[model samples]
Target: MEATSSNFTLSTILKTEDPYSSLMLAVAALVAIFCYFWIQGKAKSKNGPPLPPGPWPLPIVGNLPFLNSDILHTQFQALTQKHGPLMKIHLGSKLAIVVSSPEMAREVLKTHDITFANHDLPEVGKINTYGGEDILWSPYGTHWRRLRKLCVMKMFTTPTLEASYSTRREETRQTVVYMSEMARDGSPVNLGEQIFLSIFNVVTRMMWGATVEGEERTSLGNELKTLISDISDIEGIQNYSDFFPMVKDDDEKAPLSLTHVKSLLMDMVLGDSIVEESHLPKLPYLQAVMKETLRLHPTLPLLVPHRNSETSVVAGYTVPKDSKIFINVWAIHRDPKHWDEPNEFKPERFLENSLDFNGGDFKYLPFGSGRRICAAINMAERLVLFNIASLLHSFDWKAPKGQKFEVEEKFGLVLKLKSPLVAIPVPRLSDPKLYTA
Candidate 1:
């Protein structure tokens, strides 16, 4: 009976030959071949210092769904509780390393500074900044060096800032006048918007020298404001293509798409520009306020993702070549280990400590560290300090009726107040001349 059954099976296999069955066998054989190589590769990688520990990822999307959009920095900080300070997380196909402690930050920003100086520019950043000509996303090379030198020598030097101090004061005085009128009328003002306008005007005047007050200035300011807002929105959006570069979008490749945004400066020589830096000993408190604000809410919370040029070990863990690096300054700033009361808004902390945002101290690198630090640090400092001081010194502020003061931040390319600050400004200055536009 066993011999008869074997003969019948052999005869059936010889008699039946379907095209579908042949194709199925072929596909099965290919799959088996692929699996063999895949398993072999996995076995080989096991011998190396494995990629930093991270939560289990799904098939394709990775750990993106786990991130909270409203507060991405806080979500990342929460992850550190499970996976140590230097942990790995996948955003789509991309590998990302989150550095949350001062030690890890020092390694990436100071020790291995040259290795991680290259930026991982987003599609929007490349499109908006004229093919990455601007200093923000430019690669580390001779061109970048030239741009940095020009910025330091021509624009942000102490003499240049000092030359333009009068322009800042003039704009601040105008803002005071406008706020005083609003105070007299008992109307609530959008404090954040007002502050933005003041800073924008000061920076523009410093860059473009003098301009007549008319529809031209208003039109230019409004246009620049809209462009800036749009750029910010594009920058902060979670575009999957940024992580998975194989994906393409029509708009990103389109011509005449935000190619020449007039306000973005790299090494463009503007002969008429005038801002000369000077000693600011009297404004020590003003500087502290800006520093405190930055610590609480860095403009770029994840400090412009960096790219490792070669395979490197960071914090005793193997960081593969071309891995994305996110130095979570936001998380580091709020660490209880480094700060006394991490959540509090105490500007006095800066006054007590000698920590400056010049990238010297890893514990508080709001601007960043080493060679790729922000090129416009001096100008940014002056603009922020002047704006804050002018507003605070000119008026006493209170929340609008029926509104309570709250500190909330929204995730974006630049940190912004979740709720635009709406407050009533009460003029404190006695001299009527001080309020003139």
Candidate 2:
């Protein structure tokens, strides 16, 4: 009876107070505590390092709601006053590290360039730019390198631009004659359309071996203009897919939904196929005009988002890996630190200076910088310069009756005049002699 009682007591003790079970419970609780802290630390870090500071962000959406659609640059400038040049703002879920100062821009573009080289194309930009096949829209890779090289060597070569010089001269001569005729008739001429047409003629002729005067030119011109207009509008950027990918649902109707709009626009412009190289000049000035236009009026005053690929210090702050980066070429170009009277219209700034737009100089990268700089730089520049030069040399321009040269700018993909540039044209008697031969 004594032994039995002893065994029963031992059994009771084992059942009531198990050492192994208690130890296991303690271990599980410790693990849960550790995991909680770890997750919290990670979340804090993802919010990014202590940035230069800006307006407070809401949960999830961040400073997006605070952003004004019409005056994006102005809004950004306002934030700059509170937060120094290098500041951070969250646009929806995306983190935007804006570099308003030239010094910080230099560091981002020059020192730690590779980290910020890849581009993230917004959905609207992608659809408008031909499924991102064109050099400007393409990401950094073999295709981009190949295209870039081809553009430099075969298309935009000094010899190629020189060869196309006569094309411009001829176009200019025609424009001068047209203006002279219009002046003689005393009829109101749409100088803006004339200028646009003249440039378009020259560029298209060089690219596709046809001028805008051709039978199909009107249709093509309308299509091209529509495409450009759609791409440049602010509403395009306001789409939800650009900010919140998960919110895209076919059944849900939202102001920001882009599905139908993008589809229709793409159908009208890209309709049926890609734009082949045969459709464009294999040379540079054709590309240059495009680049210059963007510089004058960048499609996005701020480039797409970039991330710090590696941990590094910039402008005295520790820029951790995956930290968002922005290069404000618009502000940088305007800043006295890099440019003089940056607001003025001066294509001569490029010609006068040794500064090239190859992402080397932070002062004039309309296309952004680093590994992800614009793929279409070579082509865009060639097109823009070719056209601008062609128009200026071809005609002597005058403001329409009672109209002054208004350079009021409207921002989009490229800066466009708030009012399409309308002017009067008086033909030069001796165009070739009056302008540089």
Candidate 3:
């Protein structure tokens, strides 16, 4: 058997069972496994849907260089047009499946929802949120469900929101007073900053009766705004460490460092009382405006990258296990094929349609869909509606003289206005005393 060419096959060598022969057999087995996968991959390329079509990736950097920080969503949307709706992108060594079309979004978010419920956060996100322990980054299971239940039952329920109306009204009135003084002085006001401050005050007041005054409040508000802006900026950045986990992400010194994440993540407002939930039914137009805003600018452009627990087929393509899935809601929301005048700001489109933020509708998932959908939808809706309504009802807004108001958006963890909304507010209320009422 040792000398004969006829018995030189691996089976004969393995059968010899000598120490050297055994070592040779082990090496042969490893080679066989490697070749098997190589041949299988080649066959799959010919016979299976090829990892969904995608733009050719470059070595090492992959598609990283192509994504600009200011307009990453736009860049990704452009790639979808060239690569089809469901595109495969390589970010460093990581493989990301980008679902751009509503159909593809449905597949990832609905049809195979459970299979892709878990999120894969970047290293900075993990370190900031305490190893992704919070509901947003938490893996789907009992812990996530408990958090979701707390939000749905204890925090954002209709009754809880209704009880918060007094706080909402109080804060809204304060904003009105501030705006009135601005109107009297004919001074330009940063509407975005104003709205943010009003909402922040209302939320904090409801949560713990927290109050700030004078220069201190303004300083704190500016700091919080900057913190939010920084978080959004970091969330949009493509950390190579996420794509190549083997590499140290420099978590302490990363563009989105652990410190920044801690500051943003640690600041949470626990609240109960807010806007009258009953009034929501009557404010159809407000809801419509929200829908339109979400359609144009979903808070989370990519909706926390989902990861499949097991390999599965989506849109006829083979999705390997643990592959990261990016549901590009921003791209889907602006697809011309789905909505007329997709890029235009038209709340009227939703006035006649039944599309909503609920996870059921594939064509319009601003908050997302499936088991991993945003848990704070109820609270968020009320907060946004009440704040916007209060701003509109208390004063009429117009851009300051010679200043043009534009809807240009900056992409981030949450979409933001490229410029702070600067406007002149004219008092709408009949009596100045009403501001305190």
| Candidate number with greatest lDDT | 3
Candidate 1, TM-score vs. the true structure?
0.80
Error of 3 at 416 (Å): 1.0
By lDDT rank, best first, the candidates go 3, 1, 2
lDDT of 3 at 169: 69
Q: What would the per-residue lDDT of candidate 1 be over residues 317-421, giving only the tens digit for each residue?
A: 777777888888899999999999887767667789899868888989888898889878887877765565556656677767788656577787677766666
Off by over 4 Å in 1: 1-48, 210-226, 249-280
Please give each candidate's TM-score. 0.80, 0.66, 0.80
Which one wins by lDDT: 1 or 3? 3
lDDT of 2 by residue, 329-380 (tens): 5666667666666555444354455556686766677767766666556545
**TM-score of candidate 2 against the unseen true structure:** 0.66
- Which scores better on TM-score, 2 or 3? 3
The runs of at least 3 residues in candidate 3 whose Cα sits more than 4 Å from the true structure, single-residue gaps closed, are 1-49, 249-280
Worst 10 residues of 2 by lDDT: 250-259
